[model samples]
Each structure stands twice: as C-alpha cells, then as structure tokens.
Target: MATTLDAPGRGTRRARAPHPAPAVQAPTKKYRLAAAGFLSPALVLIAAFVVLPMVLTLWISLHRWSMFTPITDMEFVGLDNYRAVVASSTHMAAVRNTVVYVGLSAAVTIPLALLLALLLYFPQLRGRGVVRVLLFATYVVPTVAIVIIWSNVYAPGYGPLDNLLALVGVDSPGWLSNPDAALYSLVIFNVWQMLGYYVVLLVAGLTQIPEEVYEAARIDGAGPVRQTVSITVPLLRGALVFVLLMAVINSIQVFDPVYLLTQGGPVDATNVLSFDIQRTAFQNGLAGEASAMAFSLLVLLAAVAGILGAVRRRA
Candidate 1:
C-alpha cells in the first residue's frame, strides 16, 4: 500500500512539472475601442459637413430647383442644367477669363516668389528678419482691407499710381475699368498678395537642406548660379511642387479680388469660374446650373492636382 501511494504521488508531480503557464495576449479590443473613441469627433464632423453637403449638391445638380421655390416644386431635370451651362455664351466667357487669370497669376507669381526667396536666403543679406516680417505682413492683413487699399492706389482720377504715370508723361489707362487691362490688374494684385507666403515656404525648405551640400559645391568651385540650378533647385523640388499646386488651385478659384475690384464688369473681362457660379446661384437663381458649373470646376482642379502629384512623385 505505501509503494502504491508513492507511485501515485510521483505521477502527479510529473504531470504538473511538464505543464507550463499559458501566454498572455495584449488587449487588442480595448486598444481599438480607445482609438475609435479618439477619432469619433473628427469623423462625425467630416461626415456632417463635407460628405453630406457633397452628396446634397450632387443630388441638387440633377434637379431644377431654386431657393425661392418650395421643396415640393422641385422637378427632376436630368442633365439639362449641365447642357445649358456648357453651351451658354456667358459661361464660355467665364471659362476663358478663368484660364487666362490662372495662367497669368502662375506665370507672374511663381518667378517673383522664387526670386524673392533666393534673395532672402542669401547669408550676406542684412536684417533678414525685418525683411521677412515686412513681406509676410501682407498675408496677415484682412482681404477686404487689402482690396480697399489697392483700389484707392489704382483709382484713375486721384490714385498715386496714375499720378506718377502722368508725371512720367504717359497716359494712365483705367486699370480696373478697361476690359483689356482689368484681368491683368487682377493678376498683378494676386501675385503681390501671394508672393510673401510662397517666399516664406521656400525659405523654410531652403533652411532644411544640409549645409554640407552647399559647402561641397563651393569647394568644387561651383558658382552661385550653378549651385542654384544644380543643387538648390533639385533639392527644392518638393517645395516647388507644393507651391505650384497651391498656386493653381488659388488661381482657379479666384473670386474675392475680382468681385471687389471689378465685379466681373467691363464686358465680363474679369469674370472667373467662381464668380460665374456665384452669379448663377444667387443673382440668376439657377441653382441646378450653378451646381453643374461648380462641379466642372472641381473636376478640372482635381485633374490638374493629379497630374502635378504624379510629376512630383516621379521627380
């Protein structure tokens, strides 16, 4: 009997020794729940504001609807609004003006911004901080205030610019009133307004570049022009792409300055896509048509952005 008990005790100890403790797993469910909780507010806001409105606009664009009419009066018009907007002479004019404005603004703004950035980035420049602040001050000023100031400065009868031109024995054309010059004037204004912001961005990008690269270039007897074209420009590719994309988008949607300065006047010379949409929706009460026009603008911008992004990735 004692021998039998000893055998049973030994068997029990062997069984316990061979069995190890089970491994513990992290609480993935709890972690996921916490992440979801953190993201709830932003997700809710985006759904409510962006997603909902976009869906509503798409739906509205399919119907003949007006702000003044009752909801019950809404009638499904299919693609009639889209056809009308595309065929309208006024709409065509707006499209042409918008293309010109964007092209002009990009041509003038990008080069000026790059030049200013280069000047400011030079180590020999004194009082760089003050210069940066002065340039950036335009960005901080209210848009309406800038419009008012520029309007006064460009006024034909009593403006400083015209007076100076008169002193130089040159006739001053009506900058904002003339059909030929109004769009160009808007382009110049946009370039001046946007130059500071782009300069700051370029400067930041320039600063992030390793100083050793420049030193190496210098030791190799590379002149400033060669250094800029070869090393600086290549490294600044990312920043240049970003600035160019923003410039394109801004130029396409230009409204405030044109509206404030020209009111899309002088035979629709300064009318742009944004102004066209506003006039169609509000002034003409053509909600469906306006939505169609806006959608077209959105598609154009998206296509441009996609092309730019592809180029940037390749670079």
Candidate 2:
C-alpha cells in the first residue's frame, strides 16, 4: 500500500497494487492418468488392426510368399513385388480407371451435392424431410440390395432403362456388357448410390453458415449468385474439402459393385484396384505382390491426404 497527499484540506488517500493474473495450471497426474485410461482402448485397437497389419504387410512385401505356405519358408525378393505390380498391364489399367473414376465422381458429385444442399437449406419446401430421408436411406441400404437393384435396372432386354430409352427414340447401348460403356455405367451407378450421402454432408455444412451473412448480402443489394460466390462457397471450403477427399477415397476403394454385379468382367472393364488386389492374392496366390499393391495404395492415399492438408493450411 502507498499513501498520496490529497489537497491540503483532504485526508491522505491510500493506493493498493493490482493483483497478478493467475497462471494456467498444468493437468494433475490423476487427470492425465484418467485421459490415458480412456484412450487406451482405442489406441490398442488401432495398434492391433491398423499399425501391426501395415508393418507385417511391408515385411511380407519383401518376401516371395505363397499365401498358403508358411512365412518361414518364404524367399527374399526385395523390390521385385513392387516391380511386378508396376509392370503388370492389368494393374496399370486399374490405376488408370481409378484416376478416371475419382475425377469423374468428384466432378459430378460435388456440384450436385452443393446444389441440392442449397435447395434443401434455403427453401422451406414441403416434403423436404421425406425427400432427405429417402435420399439418405439409399446410401445406408445394404450393398447387396443396391447391386441387385442395379443389375435388374441394367438388364439388357426387358429392362426398364432400355425400354424407356426406346420410347425416347434412343437405343440402349449395353449398360454393363460393352467395355466402352461398362466403366461409365458403373460411374453412373456410383453417382446414384452416393449422391444422397454427399448432399446431406453438404447440407450439414450449409447449416453452419450464419443466416445473418445472407441477410447482410441482400441488404447490400447482392443477388443470389453473388451471395453464393462471395459468402456461401467461401465459408463452405472446409466441408467441400472433406467431401472431395471422401469421394476420391470411395471411388478408389470401389469393389463391391464390381465384385457382385460385373465380377470385374465384360473383359475386366470394371476392374478396380481393390478387386484386382483380391484377385491377385486369393485367386493367383501371390501374397507378396498383393501386399506390395496394398501398400502402394496406402502410400497413394497418404500422399493425397498430405497434399490436401498442406493446401488447407496455406489457404
């Protein structure tokens, strides 16, 4: 405390020092232990399912192991598995098809998702709830059911698609039979199956944008398109990035439809990486080569994720 002289007629006044701000306390040992205890299950599961498998795969990729034979009897063939994968014509075709699939899927899905989200969000339209539910239900339905439905839809003759096309004066080209149309037909199937899911994801993102932003834009005399370009799209970047990443991952990992419907058939027209890896390992019994392919896919995904993360950080 300190005293200062007031006016001669007034008594002296006392002043006190200000209090210091409190420091942030570190977590106590008990708190830390509790956190670790809560996290242990997830950590253990990841170790067992993901990390250990990746390590074992890399080790196996260095050996020429017939999957049926014991690991101990394997011969070392470092880098040969990778070389063989890189050199295989079918493998290369799968890679090319994957690139096209990912690109085409994202191109169609993103814009459509955004458009549907905007429509669903901005308007208080009737039956919106029912529509949303129906769309999303398609995504959650069993893959076997989806494949069966699509198979019937794509049936060459007496199929609704072909019959409908005939009415429009356009002959239905073979949906899954012609190699030229097979991959494309699969892309269309993919779009129909996943469109609802993407739309919901985008709608959730749309809800995060403040209504006040749109209101302000209107006050400033900005039109709908201007507001979307300036406010909606810019604010929705995080969600857009996630949707694109998911689309690419889903496209690349496509296997079920190929396996069930086409059997990677019509002359391997629908051959994708996942189905190819399955065929290489289980059918051909080249475990090491299959391991190499799987590991390479892992690396590709990591690289893509890294690139997207870097771009997000920069932006």
List per-candidate RMSD values in Å. 7.0, 2.3
Best-performing candidate as measured by TM-score: 2
Q: Which segments of candidate 1 are over 4 A away from where they belong? A: 1-27
lDDT of 1 at 296: 78
| 60-100: candidate 2 lDDT, tens digit per residue | 89989997888788999999999999999999988888888
lDDT of 1 at 64: 94
Alpha carbon lDDT at 258, candidate 1? 76
Clashes of each: 0, 0
Per residue, candidate 1 scores C-alpha lDDT tens digits across 1-315 of 122223654553223335568789776998989999999999999999988877777788889988678866878999999999888999999999999998888888887888888899976777998999888888778889999999998899789989999999888889998899999899888988888988898899899889899999999999999999999899999888888988999899888997788889889999899998999899988889888888778779989999999888876
The global Cα lDDT (0 to 1) of model 2 is 0.90
Cα lDDT of candidate 1 equals 0.87
User: What TM-score, computed on C-alpha atoms, does each candidate reach?
Assistant: 0.89, 0.93
Where in model 2 is the C-alpha error above 4 Å?
5-13, 27-34, 313-315
